[model samples]
Structures are given as C-alpha cells and as structure tokens.
Target: MTFQKISILFACLFALNTFSQFQVDADVRARFEYRHGFGNLFPDNTDPAAFVTQRTRLNVNYKLEKLTVLMSFQDVSTWGDTKQLAIGDNNNSFSMFQGWVQYAFAPTWAVKLGRQVISYDNQRIFGGLDWAMQGRFHDAALLKYKNKNFIADFGFAFSQESQRNENTDFLLQGAFTYKSMQYAYLKKTYNKGLVSFLFLNTGFQDFTDANNTIVDGVNYRQTTGTFFKFPINTINFEGNAYYQSGKATATKDLSAYNLALEAIYKPNNTVFGLGFEVLSGTDQNGSSKNKSFFPLYGTNHKFNGFMDYFYVGNHANNVGLNDLYAKAVFKTGEKSTLLTKVHYFAANNTLINNADTYLGTELDLVYSKNLLKDVSMNIGYSHMFASNSMSLIKSGRSNNNTNNWAWVQLIVKPTLFSNSK
Candidate 1:
C-alpha cells in the first residue's frame, strides 16, 4: 500500500506540474535577550547575561490536483559564537527543518508522511514550539478524514538508532523523546463553538534494570484529553482537561492530570481575559506512585508566564503548579498593540516541612508594532516578585534579589517566488 501511494503521488506530481502551483518563501527572526532570572530565581552576586540568537528559514511548497509537497531548511545560531575567519562551522547548525508529502486518495481522505509538525487546539499537549530557535519536528505518518463539520486524524511514529542484523535495541537517548508513538484526534465544529478529543500513547525504551544492568523492552505511557471553546455574544470561554497514566519508568507507576479554564471578552478594539490552571504534582515527602504532570511536547513558554519559570525544560516530576492570571490588550495605534498580564502562582501539592504554598507573582508587559508589510518588532519585560516559598524549590536562592527579564525581537517574512503571482 505504501509503495502504491508513493508511486501515485510521484505520477501526479510529474503530470500536473504544468498546471500546478509552486512557491518559495523565507523567514528571518532575530532576538536579543537580557536575563537576570529568566527560568529560575536570581542568586545573589551573579551578573546578568545578555545574548542574541537568530533563525533563518527557506520554505518551498508545491501543490498539484491531489498531491502536495513541502520542504523547509533552516539555520539557527547565536551571534559572536563563530570565528570571523573560520573555514567552516563546527556546530553544524544548518538542517532540514521540515520535509513532507501528502496525497489525497478520496474526496475526504488523505495520507501524509515525513518530518512534520503536529499541533492542535490550544497547544497544551502538542505544539510546533516555534519560539525556540530550533523548532520541533516529528518523523511520522498520518491518516486524515474530514467532512462538513467533523474531522479525524490518526498518527503513528517509530524510531530506531541504526540498522542492526542482530537485535532491536534502541539506545537513542533523550529526556522526553519516545521510541514509538500513536495517537487519534477527533474534532467537531458547530456554528460558533468547537470541541476536540485526543488520545496519545507513547512508548520509551527500557534498557536498565534495578541493579543498572541491561534490559531490553519498552514502557508505555498514555494521555487522554479534551478541549472545547464556545462564544456567547462578546464573551468567549475555553477550557481543557487532561489525564496521564501508565509507567514513566520500568518500575515507576504514573498518575497525573491537568485542568485549565479561561474567559475572554473582546469589546471594540480592547480585550480582557481571566484564566486558571492546575497541574497535579507529587507530594514533597515521598509517595509510592508518581503524580507530577508534564505537558510533554506543548508550547509551554506561551503559558505559565512568558518568563518560562515553569515547564520549559525544567520542573518535571516535582511539585506541580497552580496559576491564576488576568490580562488585557489595548490597541495603541493603527499598527501597534500593547499587552499586560499578571499571574499569581502557587503549589498544587503539599510542600516540604509544611512550607507555604504561595510561590510568587509575575507581571508581564509586551509592545508590538508592524513596521512594514513583511516586517514586525516586539519588546517585552517580565518581573517576578518572589515569596519565601519560591526560594525553597528554586535552588534556595535569596528572594530579595531583583528578578526580571527583558527582550526585543524582530521578524521578517517574504514570499520570494509564486507561480500565481
């Protein structure tokens, strides 16, 4: 079946090129950041860090009657990190960011394969993670079906280290990467509301025993969730609920959950909103089962404050988070906007030695403006007012230290070539 699909796709591609559409585009983004306590509490007597990073990408897309193909190449690097007169780069930061092909066999059915991005809904479970200089991609295959107001997608992925004639032992290492993954997503759309359901199963290679010996097997984990959005007049409400279970390791049993709700009111050119979220956590003392909830592949930096103090490559399998936030957005000019948000943070589980649960409060401000048709700029600042309890989990640093971060970013995207144009 796979061979037949590929053959049909190529045949269509060759026959329809004369009447097909092809396009080329580019994206360039540069960001400068000043970090005093970006991801953690600032310790006393430590100098703040400043740096600039950039991501440049070239994208090619081709579309025929029933087939489509896309390829993207990108280079991500930091300024002042390479030698001016070097013959070549040692880091090899250039890579194929995405290469995918899709073929629609029926009016409402299609199959897509290759390296691609899997993001849906609010991105609380899976996301593209475009904020990172090196964005995320998955090598997988998907089967999609869609009708008037209903859609369904089934995805599968498997990984291996290399071709070996002897055994199927995968030693490829990563903190959150899975050896195998399968998922199903379904969505229903109404007049002004939508609801979606997702079920994902991920398997990890288990290679170590209790005594640190070699074992060959796989441990599986499961995540199930639902997301919904509804609008009533000028107020919109959105929420999500998710649960995680199964084995996190060879010997550990997992049990965790996440819940969130938000309401937004957009009257005229101004917007206001309020939100609350909870992620289950393990007890500080100890427990027979694990309870900490991790968002896995979500765009976590977009949540829990832009400062990324939680769930951005840190804070896993520990005390979970409870966040209550309020935000407002104002149109400052014809092409400019300003946003302000405040978050009150706390713990979802009991703290060690009966410590306080109140972690800290954060304030974030962002200003954005469009300079040209394809150019835009953004400036942001965030401050964390830490409490004594926050010091307990964040390296025991002094809460009195000034904890703040600031950044500026510029983005430009242009269409280099288009057949239709």
Candidate 2:
C-alpha cells in the first residue's frame, strides 16, 4: 500500500477507538535562509555569490492513554541567481522525516516502536541529528525503564546506511543513568544533575553484492562514554569522555577517544558559557590513523559557532580536532533576547609534515523575539574564516586563505496549546 493509504488507515483506527483519554497536538515551523561564499570556499562556484533558501516543517502528535504517535514532514526550496549553485536541486520538495509510536507501560517502563529517534546519553554515540532542515531519524525499536533514581534503555536499528556508507547496517545500544546528585562530588548540591553511562554497538548485516557475495567484510563499531553535569551557584560544569573502536566497511580497524568540558553560567536572562574539546590521534597498532570524536549532546549550531565547518559529521575521519568555544546571551527586554558566539578550532594532528594545523575561526549572532502571546521569531547570522592548513577549504595546490562564508536565517513558530500540572 502507499504511504497515504497507510496514514489514512492509522487515522481511521485511532478515530474508531472510543477513549476519552485521547489527545492530539500539532506544530508547524517555517524558515528562510541566505548563504554566501567567497574566494573558492565552496565547490562549483561560477559567480561565487549569495543565495536564498526556504524550509517548512509540520509535526503531528496523537496520544491515547499510554500510547503516543508522532509524524513530521518538511518542505524545502531555494531561489535567486545563485540558488541552484548554492543549495542544489536535490533538496527540493517535501518528505517525511519521522513517524513513530510509543507505548508507556507505567511511569517507569516504556517502549517506542517504528521509525523513531534513538538518542542516548550525551548523543556521543546516537542522536536525532536535529540541526539540519531535514534532520535524521532511525528506523528502529527502543525500550526504556526508569526506577526512582536509576534508568536503563536499549535500542535496535536495522536496514539503513549513513551518508558515508553504502552498506545496510544494524545498531544496538544500551545506556544507564544515575540521578542521585549527592552521589557524585561535582553534582552534590545540584538537585537536577545526572550522571550517565552509555554503550553502543553498530554492525553491518548482509552487506554484500546483489549476487549474494561479500564485497567488503562486515563492519563493526563499539562506543562507550560517561557524562556528568554539576551545578555551582549560577554556573554549571558539564563533561563527557568516550572511547571508540571500529572498522569501516572497507577499511582497517581503528581506535579513537574524545574528551569534552564546559562551564555554563546563567544568572537570570543573561548567560555566558565556555567549552573545550580534544580528540586524540596517534600511530597505534602500526597504523597512522586519526582519532574519532562526536560533539555529543551539545547543540552543534550553538557550539561550533554557526559556520558549520566542523563537528557537523561532514568531515569525520581525515583530521582530529581541538576546539574552544564561548557564547554570551543578553536579554534585550521581556520579550526579546540577543545571543552571540565565537569558536576556535585547530587540527590535533598534522595534515602534512610542514603545514601548520590551525583550522579556522567562526562567529555567530542571533536575535529572538516573541511577537505575540504564543508566536515567536528568530534571526541568525554566521561567518567563517579559513586558515592555510585547512585542507577542506583548499583548491588545487594553493591554500585558500581568503576563503570565507556567511549565512542568515529567519524562523517563525506559533504554539497551539500547553498543559501544566
């Protein structure tokens, strides 16, 4: 059957259930963005100028007693002289990003089935990928339970490949969380603080040619991490560490690790934060390899300072990274706020023997305002500067030192209803 038929069938089924505990909610968002590149920063630049694009999202959720269903659809388009050159035609049209059903078996036990999002502790190993206009969703089943201060979760993902691979894969993950703030030294006084541990395993199944022959060996990856949050006065300390070992579909086995630390100080409407991260890389096991790292649960757009040059999962393996980030937020009034951020990133390993490894710097600014009681709008801009050692920005044999890029985005959101207990 077609997707529309399936959707209509589900809706009819829900309508037939005579339950007073049923509830429905919906949300929609629209965004317009403009991007410009200069000095050979982006590939295939005939005029090398600016462009505009638009995106719209609609989400519907239905709940009946302990069962909940969710679906999201998005539409994307571009315009202007450089629209085709900058945004590409592949992004045009509408698509479903997620569809899932969740069942709750008491306050502490729940299971989500169907195409859902599998986000775990710190998102170092698994995430929903919500930064993009059309975010990532998983086709999987997840089970979760929480008893008092302890929580456990497990998930299984099947029949898919990520942007970097061609093989269908499966993912298994387990995570645990301890919510007693008094047990950890850093979290003793913070009632809402938590400590979590996660383990993720990904394996490829039947990754072979159409003739039922194996072209590359089955791939496997294991990731383990611990994350904690501590609050002191108006400042909060957050940290995470992860170790990963994996072999790509056609590559040798590799091992890597990551470390992240941040301090967020929020005193009323104004907030200031700073963070540092490191990814380790060395010649281990007789292979000159690069260490892997995930930015974890942090908002990629907010942390990497909007230029989206690194840590967005675009350039993952070739270079290790060390990043320093800072942000400041100011409340302009009761209904408006202004935010700005800066990021400095450098390569942890040498791109070449003689080349320096400083990656680039980024600057971002955003303004948000509440236009009405339940309506809001946001505007943002970002700029990036490329260094001589940044291989991703290089063209031919010359380092594109003059390369730079900028983006602007506007968003509008209106809420329908909210319930408070």
Candidate 3:
C-alpha cells in the first residue's frame, strides 16, 4: 500500500482504540447512460454516447455521547478510465465526500465542522446534488439547535485555492458560483404541517487587470425565502417564495424573485401531482436592469425538466423561466413503481433580441424496482420537443430535431463492519 493508505489505516486503528463506538458502511452505484441529447446541445454528426459510470463510497462513523464524527471516502468515474496509470502520476478521482465532527456542549446547541452536505426544505436554494455521480459537498462549519417542534441551522463557508499564493483575488470556478457564502435556516413544525425560512448571502470575486493596478471588485447577493407544507385530509400542498437583491456576480445591478406552488394527492398506490413555478425575468429594453431570478445551488434536475435545458448550468444572465408540470405515479408492487411527468416551459418574457416566449414541452418516464434488500435498479427516459425559442436559446438553430435520452442505474448499499453497542 501507498504511504497515504497506510497512514489512513493507522489513523483508523488509533481512532477505534480511543473512540467509544465505531461503525463502517459502503455504497456502490453504477449507471449505464445512452445520451442522444442529454444536455442542452450536442455537436453535429455525433452519435449517441453509451457508457457506464460508477460511484463508490466508504463511510466511517464514530460516536461518544454528545460528540459524533463521520468520514466518507468516495470515487467517481467511468469504467476502464483509470487503469494502468503512468509513473508517479496517479488517478486523482478519489476524494473525501464528507468528513465532519459534531460536538454538543449544551442540551440544545451543537457545532459541526468540516466537509458536509447542506440541504433544506425542498432543496430549492441549497441542496446536495445527488443526481451527479460525484455528488456535492461544502467545506464549512455549522451550528444547529433543535427541539421537538423547532430547528435551526447557521452555516458559513469560504474557499481559497492555495495558502502561499499571496493572491488578493478570490478564485471562482465560475461567474455564477459563489466564492464565499453564509446562510441561516429555521424551521417550525405544526400539527400535520411544517414551515421553513432561509436567508442566504453570497459573494463573487472579480480580479483586476493583468497589471494589478486596480482593486479587485466583489459582488454580493442575498436571497431570502420561505417554504411551507401542510396536509389537509387526503391532499398535500406546498408553497415557496424567494427574493433576491444586490449586485449580480457578472452584472452591476440585480433584482429578482421566484415563487412556486404545488399540490399532491396520494390516497393509495397511485399518486398525482401538479405544480407551477414563476421566475421574474429581465425586460428586453436596454435601460431595464436585470430582473431574472436564479435558484443558486438548487436541484434543478428535480424541477423544470430532466434534460437540464433550463437551469442546469445555462440560462443565467438571460431570460427567466416558467415551468408548469404534472406527474403521476403508480406502484406496481411493494418493490416496484412507475412514474411519468409532463412539463410545459415558457420564457418569463421575450429575449433581448425579441424571441418567442414558448420554449417547449417535455415528457419523462421512470421505473424503479428493489431487486434485493440492499440493491435497487431504475430506468428512465426523457424526450424534449424543442420550440423555436428553446432551440434559439440552447442552439443557434430555430428549427432543430427532437431530443431524446435514456439511462439505467443500479444502486447497492451494504454495511461491511459494525461492532457498536
């Protein structure tokens, strides 16, 4: 074994000797995808991509009364991509997905530090992007308080590329992604219902010119929102509203908001749901400041459409969106289910160059089955009927062909070792 592996093994052994309890678990997921048009666009004359990707994770847990610790190692990649590495240069796909320690000194307060996942409400603002094989994690610290009916969490994070660079400019991966962030989340539970409030503040970095004569500029943005869900008899309803202010990452001015409402009826194995989301958009006029709202760090795939043509990395600094959709779910058996969804999308307003408002329609279908106690499988398909607007927005073509995609996935989770009492 390498030095790193040996060091980790020794550390694990030491922790086991000192900790009051320890446990271990593992997860493996493989997905085979046939992508004719998965994302917004594909190059011309390119055949559909068919490949298998896998993610494997091993987790260790330690607990001692008011203190708890967790560490997870993850590797995500396609098959046969990392075989027979060259000398001294190894495959670098493995990473620490989560490593955190939580300690509670008071009965109602606790603090957690290190890398972790932050998800709230319906994961509209901050989410763990589980759809992606690598998933998502944040290196930060969090303080949480909870009781029977109330819970609250406060988190802060800052990112830097290196320690000895002596650089003043913040290194941002993208313009829209945050370089620094903080948030406050509060939740209250009522009989048969619950409500959550969130406030998130983010900042983006802008470096000066090459000569370093100018000060690096920074843009700050704030998002405040509330989410509520309640059940009335046999029907369940939820609503969300969020507003954004302050300068955008790339623009000098920003003012935006988004609102949504949804209802679900599930009296039996069959279920039905309907929802609508409205996001403010910028006007086509040059004088109008940008009014488009963005759900930063959200699970966009869960909304809009699975094809990710709307908010999954595109559509920023552009026209906003409106998504109206319906879904039906039928449980075939105790271990099998089928789900179908339909969506109609439109631009909140015309584009800057005066394009049409109707974007397109999409259909999605999925089937899931539990093969064994620790294994599950899923198959999904999606088709997008692009309109003149969608084609113009995604591709330059105003008259493009239909887009289709398919995928099959299998998940396996197991506990390798557990000797805690």
Candidate 4:
C-alpha cells in the first residue's frame, strides 16, 4: 500500500535467500472501469456494472551456473471488496502466482518444472492472460532447445484434483477441463521472415457412462498451426493458420480451423494496420458433429475488438466469426501515444434459423502515457453496435440496451533489488 511497506516486504524476501545472483522486483497495477456493456450484452432495464480492480505482485529470481529459480506472489482484488475479512487471516485468499525452476544440462537442452505461463508466437493458441485480475498459469514441465536460428520447446501437463491419494483415480478438478495436455513448438528464422510451427494435444477426463454411471475416460484433441512474419519495405506482413481435429469431450467428432492475415505500415512516428480473420463455424442443419473453432487458450481479448463481444466464451460451439478491421496509432510525443481501431464483424456461416450473416461493428480508442520512469497510464473506450443476428445469438441474454465501456489503468513496475555486479 505504501513505498515503505513494499520495501519492508522486499527485505523480508531477501532475508530468505543467500545467493550470488539474486534480484527482486515489484509490479502493481490499478484500473478503474465503467462498463455499460462489458463482457455481456446489457438489457434496457439493468444498470451498468462499474468497478475498480488491482493487482500487486512481487517476484524474486536467483540464478547460478547450473540452475535458475524464480518465485512470484500476487494479490488480485476489487476495490473495497475485502472489508469483511480481517488482515492476515488464514482464510488465505492469495495465490503463489508463479513458482518454477530451470536446470540446464547442456548448451542446447534445458528443462523447467513447476507452475508457469506459456506464451507463443502471435499468442493465437496459448498465452498469458494478463488482462484478467488472476492471470493464467499451468502446472507442467517444459523441455527447451535453443540455437542460432532454430529453437524448439515441448510441454507436458496433467491436471488432477488429488495428488498422492490412492483413493482418487487421477480426476481433474472441473468438468470440461483438460485431464492431460502436451505440445511441441519449433521455429526457424529466415533471411526475410521467420516461421514457426506448433503442435498441441489435449485430453479431457470422462465422468459418465451410457447408463449414467461414474467412470474415467479420455477424449482428446490436437491442434496444429504455423505463424509467419516478414517485412517488405516499410510494410510488415504477418499471417497464421491453425487447424484442430480429434474428438471432443462428448466423443463427438470435431473439426475446426482459424485463418488470419495482417499488414502493418509504419512511416515516421505514425503506424497503420489492416487485417482480416475468420474462424470456421459448425453446420447446424447438416450434421450432428461439432465444427466450430476455438482459439483454445489464447488471448482472445486482443482480437475481436477489446469490447470482447465475440468468442470470449459466449460463442464456443455456435456460429463462427469473421472480422475485418483497421487501426492507426499516432505517437503524440516521446512519451505519449494514441490509437484508434474500427472493426466489422460477421458470422462465418449462415444461421440455420435465419440466414443472417451480419453481426455488428465496433470502435475502440486508447491512449497511453508515461508519467515516471517506472510508471505508465492508459485509458480506453469501446462501443459495439450489434445487429439482429447478434440478438438471435445472444437470445434472451442481452438487455437490448446501448453497449459501451470505459476504463483507465495505471501500471508500476519497480526493481526493488538487484546486484549488477
């Protein structure tokens, strides 16, 4: 809450370690938002939701010749929501955000173990969801390889509710959750552009049988994709294509894909972007199988407009989406920048009930400025204009009211301790 308290906390963390190379850092973010139409559509009668959220983090790193270790603790909460709880209570409403260790056996091979975040090229399928108050992390193991122009990484994980308990049969905590997962990513850099390939496999736990009896089964899906980026003169081009197959949780056949391309031009201090993206949709009238593409664990908010009107969890197996958008960023000064984006959204497939393909349009505006060496401020506003098809998709959900959102956020990351020597 104050600089003195933060310093004391850092000192306490340092007291626990006696390493040759150690560093401690602190990160704090506070955001106030007014959501007339946040994640969901608003009804005409219901009032908009408004709140302030904050995240505080402290991280420590210790490195040696053969091993490297990191530990980060975080607290995420809404403003004025904890008045009923006592401080330091064992209620223990906290997270050990990240705890991991990496060991290098050779120059090109290393393994990292523990709970950490996974982010990849374009973050189209896997990402660190930093926008959320409690960010995303995975308990897994990763094997890494690095070289001059090539790199490869493989990750494996299995989620379970009880560990080392013989009575439990390795059951994952929640329904529709992955019981086990694995992925392999490889990348190669070329003279003109860089290309990367990814292969991810996920298995979900089965909980029921034909007779509605409890059972343990496995349903699996695999995702494969490639991402590329290159530069031509002042214009930079980028694109990606991904496909998914295998069976879904219900053992239904699954087939899906996503394709996107973008070109960015930066001349002087101003930048411009043009992009198009499409996700395949299921054919409701034709088959009993599912075909809608899910981005899996990617940062969906970065796409489909910041308003998060599409695929943020609302349209998983329904009609897919098509997005055509453009944006411009103007660097106002050395420390300030402004960005504006416009998007046109449509359904990827014709609706079985109504042949409507038109979804809606959205506009987003953002401004950011640095106030101190370690502090920055950001403000944003977004509005979505829904169509009749949107009403049909959101059927009985949204309040048929105006949809808009506004927010202001501040980020502070400070290096509490470091030994440059």
Measured against the true structure, the TM-scores of the candidates, in listed sequence, are 0.93, 0.76, 0.93, 0.92
**What would you estimate as the lDDT of candidate 3?**
0.83
Least lDDT summed over 10 consecutive residues: which range in candidate 2?
A: 178-187
Clashing pairs in 1: none
| Candidate achieving the largest lDDT | 1
Q: State the lDDT at 392 in candidate 3.
A: 59
**Residue 101 of model 2, lDDT score:** 86
Per-structure clash totals for the candidates: 0, 0, 0, 2
Q: Single out the weakest 10-residue window by summed lDDT for candidate 4.
A: 167-176
Q: Could you tell me which residue pairs clash in candidate 4? A: 42-399, 43-399
Off by over 4 Å in 2: 1-18, 21-26, 38-46, 49-52, 79-92, 120-124, 160-190, 205-214, 249-251, 281-286, 294-299, 392-412, 415-421
Which stretch of 10 consecutive residues in model 1 shows the poorest summed lDDT? Answer: 1-10
Which model is ahead, 1 or 4, in terms of lDDT?
1
- As a whole number from 0 to 100, the lDDT of residue 4 in candidate 1 is 56
Instruction: Report lDDT (CA) for all predictions.
Output: 0.89, 0.60, 0.83, 0.83
**Candidate 3 segments exceeding 4 Å error:** 1-3, 6-10, 85-91, 165-168, 209-215, 284-287
What TM value does model 4 have? 0.92
lDDT (C-alpha) at residue 108 in model 4: 91
